[model samples]
Target chain A: MTLLKAWQMPIILGMVLLLALFLPQMQLNLYVQMVLMYVGINIILTASLNLVNGYLGEFSVGHAAFMAIGAYASSILTVLILPRRWGPAEALRVVPLIGPELANGVYLVPAVLVGGAIAAVAGLVLAFPSFKTRGDYLAIVTLAFNMIVKSLLENSGDIGGLVARLIAPLSASLSADVLRLSDAVGGPRGLLGMSKLTSLFWVCLWVIVSLFAMRNFIFSNFGRGVVSIREDETAAGLVSVNTCQVKVLTFVISSFFAGVAGGLFAHVLQFINPRSFTILKSTDILVMVYLGGIGSLMGSILGAAVFTILLEVLREVIPLVGLSEVWRWVVGPLLLVTLMIFRPRGIMGLREFKGFLPKEEEVKPQAAPAPP
Target chain B: MPQPVTTLVQQTLNALQVGSVYALIALGYTMVYGILTMINFAHGDIFMVSTYLGFFAAAWLLGLALNMPPLVIFLSTLLFAMVGTATLAVIIERVAYKPLRQAPRLSAVITALGVGIFLENFTLAVIGPEPRTIPPLFPLVNLNLSGVFVSTIQIVIIGVSVIVMIILDTIVRRTMTGMAMRAISFDKTIVPLMGVPVDRIISATFALGSAIAAVGGILYGMAYQLDPYMGIRIGWWAFISAVVGGIGNIRGAFVGGFILGFVEIFTPVFLPSSTYRDFVAFSLLLLLLVFRPTGILGRPIVQKV
Candidate 1:
């Protein structure tokens, strides 16, 4: 049953992709396309976050840390490897160690995958501590990880200096250039001068991939184990599920995708700063997950799309309506509180589209048995 | 030797002052966690909002319009800020949290995040994009206690914090409401069966927590000046303190705050580089969680079947 539902989503996704491809032409506006691109990135972010918060039942508030890792890693690679050209041949030559022929077509995808993998490694650092603590402790550990990442990035100059000193003997001839390259990482000032490689196609494609992967993970046997652990860890353990393994896996997978989303965002904005990835960003993702309904994959996608649009709309409409910027904060929380109070299960809860759709018999109504 | 001693004394006093503020904020976190088992992420933002409130009241309303004496103006502003923040806390509990009482803990956590964002952005909009100066209420006077030099404001902050802690401890131990709060924490379902008003107790808890947070906010504003983003860093520290001390343990929160404060202040001094302060503090927090999840003073909460 789940597989059939999963198969159906890709078809819908393909249709959406086709529609998005023609949207710019239809609307004749570049700004709208930019907004659409942003929405796609957010879709990737909120969907992947659902894997941890919704499917795994772990509260992770440091997702942006992974995002930062991915952003920096991918940005560094792209800046160093990719030639500053839009032509097919130049793009091909820039691909790392690949023959010029295949590089142009496949290099971007590989870069994104590598970025995600790097973030997954970062996730391990955060997940190791989770073996001992759960709930609020886990939340604090993750929060600390976020702050630590930010601080480290802000203080990357000191790290660079130490590395330079260590390698001074080996690279005496090229020490100055190496130091300059290290400074390119830009410490607290932030990473600048990166090419904007994130386009609508890449963003939308990743969003689809993330949505599909999260949905499959949630419905699979492993997904059931995650839910079981969430419902009752002891009971799940007694029933033979390795609760710890499930948690660690879920966290890593979620972190990997968050990293991918971050890379996409960094490329889209063409800038990377430590301040950009803070607890506030994590909170935004969390809000999307909860507002959509915990454990509901489709709901998360919808929630992210709605929220990104709403934020933009609010920014545009609020000032026109004579509401101050302070009012924006007021409205966001007010809406969230109202949603929690009235629809705590979110818009979908654990139920899915199939569950909501009326049965064939109900749709037809059996004609009331001809007034029997 | 004398110079080192003076430095040590100054650092110690600084640690105490900062630690007291953290303890005040952590109380709100610990108290709420004790009952609801939900981390009120917005508590830190509430602290931020209170500082702004105090700032506006002091600089704009009292300082500019009323032309009152600095001491009287400061006291009145502080009082108003506390009341305003307390009301905000109660409203948050009523609006954002009360509905999620029976819902999953995750939902409440998310709502708390939402509330926090709301408070932050609201302050940003109202306060503009600049950090405002808070007029000094008390004179910056220092005292030499033996070889240690401590500022008058620091001493006052520490003294008031201790008094507040003692008063809260007494109320929790010696009052009917405190018993009711403890009862609810243990088994919320049985509280109503025992004929207690659970809602009232929870509101009181929020009110009490918010009041303490307001004091912390005002003091923090006096110390560091006022800004919307000030709450973000301090809030994280306070949250860390609550967790390090054991989330639901009040006294543990106090101890955790002081420990964190000392770690933050002393790490920089000893390392001769302030850059690694966050690294050391965060690493310590993670290690503590791994070794003693319940913290120094916190007892483990037993999970029910």
Candidate 2:
């Protein structure tokens, strides 16, 4: 017990590292591996949403918009930038310096990072709207943003044509290339045929990094500013918190991780579509955030894990009860409603697991001056 | 080609019909938001469910084979849907919303979302994803005035919506229950001290909002096929209408709904396809929020320190 209290973080992290590195190589069922990957992706999503919704106390229902941006940004890079014949061996042979197995893995890192960077830029743009609004009004802005993104993606094909025709009168070659690239995105039909590069190790690594980043941010001065904004925005500004800067920074950081998760999600599915990133998908992330608890890192982790596992379990168990697969969707919402009614604050609320956190320094007793 | 004036008049007629349906649903959204300052996200789903209720009721009436008049069947089906939907809304308020009145505001919003999702999926599970429509309550007739053609259904939809709006406006302006609701919206804490039954008034608000939505459902079902997921898209559009017109303002919602209807129909005329409808509508909403956050008819909210 004493040893664990002293070195719990290192020990637990080591175990996770070992599991991530070896789990894919083990002879585990493919289904179980997929579920684990989903768990990791969902954890990243839940944590990012928590930063905005839970900590900042903003109700953003359009988080999937950023995810869609990240997914498309990364997918376009991996599919278009890479050579036509995409294989680890081919990549390694082309690069020649890196090992065959690690070649694509190394390339994926930059692609995902680029995706996050672009999503952060998008977040920066979105954060400006938050400056002028709060609460449900802010929610409307996010919702409109989501719809606009989806519709824009759906209309990409037409946009390309319109742009090409307009430019055709000016420059012929540029118009052709623009049209080709627009069609390549697949528009409403969806982008397809991306290689499955999202391995268990990479997913687990990203999940751990996201968790650590969120925890560090929450403990930092800016994080306190975020919480204070949630508690009372006027008061926080009165105290010279530079609330606008903090809010924008928080939005960018939160959306950056959400984008990273989107890249991972795209690779796992090996396909990308505007339909995948809708209001419904955002609601799924919100459910996970609220399920475990709000304003708690441990809660986000647990919430993501439990919600994902429960979904899988219901998918399997519903069939046994003589119900169709669609019943799972019905059951999921019912559970959420029940949870809200019974425990409005969620499982963890604002509390963190004591064991997971380092001990606070014990206050030493000073010599009392006889009932002074 | 037809005269441009003919096309304009024809489109305007179409827009008015669509706008009236949207106005009905937006009124529901604005009413709930006005009374509780909470977005009843489930209101859209309630609208969807009411359409289904109307569908089943019409189907059953036609199956009775009683040689009844179409107007009687329509009115009875409308009444059935209103009562049923109002009951559901009142029950939802009591069971789901009442307990969380004192909790964080977002909790109620989230719960409303959950309830909306549950309603959609439950309807899907029971009715099996197949879209259904209410049987025609009256015979279809086309009316030609000058060069433009209009249908009897369009006139009925527009006329019924206007009548409902006038009735609702009068109720809010003159009735005791409406007065209590307006008072509560002004100051929730003190209204009960003045002998208003806050809980019952709230339930009445939910019931009234839901009843109005039922009217929209029946009209919409007559015009288009009904599906469980139909609520999501139309509900969002109606919600946007309410927001654009100024949430909690009845007249604003009416105008906003018509504006949305015009946007929906006119986008296809100017743009290459109808797909740009959502893009135009949302852009309009975003622009409005940026310029006038209070909405057209809504009073500005004062931030208390």
Candidate 3:
């Protein structure tokens, strides 16, 4: 047991290094490399959402909004402020004397962290409203927040234009090119010329870190308090768990990681739009959290990897049936519907793998709780 | 820009027409939520299926047209869509929700969402993804009532919705099945002890809700093109309306639908462009929910100790 605790992080780190540093340099196709990066990103996303949905048992259907915020926040940074030699960010590159590759690498950590910080703040703002909203009402509020963010992004051109006009006179130096004001979000055409700063290395690093963080949190006293609250909020309050503080703190951390994942997504795709972060995207992440068995860190990791690979496999299956890419979408929902019917608790269904996680973790009474 | 008075009246009429469709669809959501305390996210897709049913019925009727009136053809399409969609709803409830009745609420919600995605994709795969325009049921006739020009289509939409709601209200209030439904919603265990067949009543609820939504789908089809994914956006709005009206309260759905309709239609007027319509509409939803979580017409139950 001591050996497992002592060496797990090192072993996982070594594997991540191998995959990120060595795998890319090896004889692998670009498609495979991209899928691997996405798997890493999904791992981060699923784990973060698992904190709220799995651990806290809050029905937040608007997680993608946080991701959207992170994406735009980081994308705008990379586009408008990062080193110019990379891409669209060149126009506003105030610094010099750094090599192009080294500059890109150096710029990524802060940009992504900034994204996480911004999203975490948004989560903090939402925490108060969430205290008043319970059950399905909370779900609707989150979903609305998501739509509000998406629609705002979609109309970002006009809104940006309005703001530019309002602020341009005050600050004479803030030119259109300086602000990249002409087409910051591209107004539904999506923003382009993003610095593809997302490396397999960064993704893998974050995924490992997030997993370790989540696992540790799950095993902590604070996590036990969160779980008790999920099991029964009123009961937990009676035991003096300070459920509200736990909920807000968990939400802030979860959304912060979600933002980090979104930063990865933007840099990898080299572009982003409002369309990419819809309620559907949130639903996709939710499916992973639920499928893996909520509150199980390892399950979230497993679910992300499996779901990502399943998507890739479905892509391969489409051409074999003499159909195009859209058919893959059809197959996915069909599979999900069937899977839910047979295994509503999800593929993991609260059954955690042993050793690191106890075997019989999540499989406690499947019956609905008594009416509140 | 159009004249203020003219635009005001026109938008109000338009809101009414749109609100009627929302009311019809919201009823389905409220009804299902009342009985099961589950959202039945696929309720929107069931409405989508009804549109296709309307399409095929119209095309089939065209082949046998013996100088039949347009109104007659429209009536048949409504009938076909209602029956077909109601059956689909029953199958969905039986397969997706029935087994998970005792599971955690999240499980049921996920199942419903999966079912909705399944229904949407299945239709898209079968019929191809291009939006199909349904043939206009009748020629558009504009009537100017005190400088307000309301089209026949608008009148028909509002007219049909009211009639259906009346029938539904009567069934819920004045029938044996309705009593069983109410009893089940209140206390399923005791109702079963009272010898009421709970399963059948639930199925009947599905049938009724789905049928009303089908009528909504047909009206929506007459105004807009038919697409498989149309249910998703529209379904969300109706769900919001249901919640805004107080989810379990039938009357709440109707009132909430109109309120949402006015907000959605009018927000674009005050805003710079219609792009933020959803943003504004949903913000309004959040505001309303903040003040009154149970909705305007919904009753709150005291938490059991």
Candidate 4:
């Protein structure tokens, strides 16, 4: 029991490593690898969103905004700036931990973390007004934030034009620099030509990390405080949980992970667009959180994984059944609506798998007498 | 650039025409929210479905016409579309939202989103991704009054909207069902004990809201064109209008819709960037929420410990 508790995380990480090592050897189709990579990225996104909407019981409809920020930040780092300064091989040079594609992704860790840090700051700024909102109102405010983020990014060209007119007195070089930065964003056409640094291994590794972090945190005292607030804010405040601070912290952490996922997505797709991070994108993540048992970390993993795969599979299976391709989009939401109507709690219904429980033997490690 | 008075009149009239439709959609949103305290996210999609209904109704009417006047054709199509949309609303409430009534608030909210997605995608499946042009429901006549040109369709849309809104206001103010709806909105759990048929009144509320959505749909179609995904953005604006006016108050919706419509229209006129329309509108919504969280006419609900 003690061994199992101590070894669980390492075991999970080891499995990810082994999968990474052998996946290339297996010679799987590139499309299949792409699907797997998507699953991993989605798992990270959905799980982080679950942290906000499910665990903290807050409505954060602007998660995709954080994702967008992260994508831009990380992509700018690895694709636009770093490659120019240190060359494409700099990433491989920094940490050649393995051969081929494995080492190719080594530099993404720092870039992705930087992206997460920036997004966490954005989340903090966004959460300032959320101190007053509760439930439905929170949902609306977050949605507005999503819209604002999208519009702001999409209208970068207009902003560039406006700035040029408004700051006509500025020195030519400085104004040129400002306009250059705006142009780099690619406006509505999207920023492309990013290096494909996101490997199946990197995504899977983060998926495990997100799961581990979320689960462990959710079981900690801080996580308990958040859950208590969800159950009753008044009672949690009476018990001295510092409800407002917890809410902000939860949002920051959740946004950070979402940022990480966004960075991975950016590198994987080798493209980023403001439109891809729309209100509908956020809704898609929300659907995953709802479909998964809210507040269950494992459920988040399952929901993102299963839903991602099912979507790809359904495209083929749906048409085979003599239905139009429209059912591909229709069936998912139809299932969700019916599910919410009949089983609103979702598949796991707030229950975690038994494996998540810390072993009884590990709880009193020093106190227990050894068998020897 | 300063516009001539005539052009200004034309712009304001156009604003009013657009605002009337928004008011209608906002009313549906406000009414459902008044009773359920749920946003009814699918309300916009319901409005979208109504346009298709209007299309079908018009086609049917045109086929079976005995040289029917345009006004008569429009009226019959509007009525049939309303009934059809109202029935859909009732069914959606029953299937998607009703069972989750006793569940968590978020469940109902998520279910509402799911219903909206289903409606949108289902419409996309049924109607291919093409924007349908509604045949002119009224004869084209540009009425020139003091150099201001106004289309006959715009006048009919505004006039019809005013009449419908007045009737709805009367229904809510004077009818027994309106009083019952008000009672349910105030205290949903206790209303049944007061001998009100809570379920039936709730159903009636859905029907009323859906009917308004249908009217809004036809007007929107007349003014613009129909697309499967058109409802989401307009629906969002209508929701904002409902919130600004006081979410649960019927009068507030109309007031809010016009405010939003004018803001959206005039912001681009004054500012060089038309893209900032959404940015300005949403900023206004956030500002309103911060100062008067309950909305302009909304009554605050005391938080229970």
- Runs in model 3 deviating more than 4 A are A1-5, A84-104, A167-182, A355-372
| Candidate 4 or 1, higher DockQ | 4
What ranking of all candidate models by TM-score puts the best one first? 2, 4, 3, 1
Candidate 4 yields a Cα-based lDDT of 0.85
Please rank every candidate by DockQ, starting with the best: 2, 4, 1, 3
Better of 2 and 4 by TM-score: 2
Give the lDDT of residue A48 in candidate 4.
94
lDDT of 2 by residue, B57-173 (tens): 999999999999999999999999999999999999999989989877877888899899999989999998887778889997888888788887898899999999999999898
Q: For candidate 3, what is the total of clashing residue pairs?
A: 1
Number of the top DockQ candidate: 2
RMSD of each: 4.8, 2.6, 4.9, 3.2
Q: Score the docking of each candidate (DockQ).
A: 0.68, 0.80, 0.65, 0.73
Q: What is the CA-based DockQ of model 4?
A: 0.73
In model 1, the Cα lDDT at residue A159 comes to 77
Better of 2 and 3 by TM-score: 2
* Backbone clashes in model 3, listed as residue pairs: A84-A90
Chain A TM-score of model 4 comes to: 0.90
